[model samples]
Target: MIAARKSLDGLSAGLMLILCACWGMQQVAIKIAAPGVGTILQTGVRSLIAALLVAALMLLRGTAFFGRDATLWPGVAAGLLFALEFLCVAVGLNHTTASHMVVFLYTAPIFTVLGLHWLVPGEHLRLGQWLGILIAFGGIGLAFSAGFEEHGSTSTLIGDGLGILAGVLWAATTILIRRSSLSEAAPTKTLLYQLGVSALVVLPLAAAMGQFGAVSMTPVIWASMVFQSVVVTFASYLAWFWILRRYLASRVSVFSFLTPLFGVGFGVLLLNETVGVRFATGAALVLGGIVLVNVKRSPQPVPV
Candidate 1:
């Protein structure tokens, strides 16, 4: 049994790492796809595809897509928040560079930590945690400042602002999931709710923006969409929710610091974006802060 548990632990860690990589690559994929498709259309199609993938997975796993005990309103709310998050992110990408957007989006964790503290008592951060958050936020400021200096434009500022809003929405969604009764819902079902909701919200907006006509039936676009929908959104999200269910939220949330790191690296490689000193310095501080916030201390035993 002990050996089995050890193997399971190792497998979970491996899965988490893969999820992290996929998530990192996902930012790059979306950035690549942005040129061919309008942001809203990209988000709508991705959500629709992800919803379908999750549905297929549920079928294969013999799991129901709808939960018996889950409240419809909570699911709907979660889905709405998810949609807003994606919408903001997609639109922000159009205005800002991927490197800038990625760093700003990571501010979600900071929001999550704050929201959890208020919504879920006993989840509050200590002084050390607050210091860590400040450090991480400073990193975010640094990244933004670097981007602004590199591309001094009104549109870039707008994009950066949108990116920050997206982070807030992302954090709100996380809090909703953590605090809502929907926490008991099956992972597949919850994912479907989020994806389906986003698709519903964005599809009409994309149509209104005349993005449907902009979509080309190219192999590259199709490939990017498939990766975003099936692999990153569906698979990684399912795994993320599963991890949230099984572990402490703080513990799992801390690993998200890797997203920006991966995002910057991919931006350099795929988008040929130059990494500046400010970006490096800020990312280091942010990641260091996240580590400081999440470090676990050994428990002291009580005297019998």
Candidate 2:
């Protein structure tokens, strides 16, 4: 049993790492498609496609997609938060540098820690964790300062702010998932709620933003949309929720640090963006802080 448990833990860690890598690549994919598609259109198409693919997968796997309990409300709330997060990201990307936007989006973990402390009474960060959060936030500030100096536009600043807002929304969604009765629901049903709510929310917003007409039938655009929907958004999220349901959220969340690192690397490789000392230094600090925040220490028993 010990060996089997160890193996399962190793596999779970591996899966989480892959998920992070894929998420990192997703930033690159979005950047690639951004030039051709409006942000709203990109988000809407990706959500729509992902929802369809997830529906299909559920059908194939014989898993019931809808939750049968009061948890449904929390699931719906999570989905709304997911939609809001993406909407902010999409609109914000239009106004900001991709590098800056990526960095700002990582602030989600900070928000997560804060939210968890407030909503989940038993979970609290130690002083060391608080220090780590500060260090990580400082790193984010440094990255923002450097990126803003190099590529700052007014629109970019707006987008960067939006990205931060998106992170807050994401954190809220996570906290809701943990604190609400939805914690006991099936992962698939929970995920389906998130996607469905996001799709519903984004469709009208995208349409109102005049992104509908911007949609093209081009093979490249379609391919990017489909990949974002099926691979990154749908499959990746399914795997993520599955892990979250089975594992500790804090430990799993630490892997998110890799997303921005991968985003920076991909930006350099694919978009030909410059990778400088500032970016590297900031990234190291951010990743280090993430590690510090995530490391678990044994809690002391209360005095009898």
Best by TM-score: 1
lDDT of 1 by residue, 222-250 (tens): 78888888888888899988876655555
Per-prediction TM-score: 0.88, 0.87
Off by over 4 Å in 1: 1-16, 298-304
lDDT string, candidate 2, 17-123, tens digits: 78877777776677667767877777777787777777777798897765457877787789889998988888887777667777778778777877766665445
Candidate achieving the largest lDDT:
1
Residue 174, model 2: lDDT of 79
CA lDDT, candidate 1, residue 109: 80
Which parts of model 2 have CA positions greater than 4 angstroms off?
A: 1-9, 217-219, 298-304
Question: Which pairs of residues collide in model 1?
Answer: none
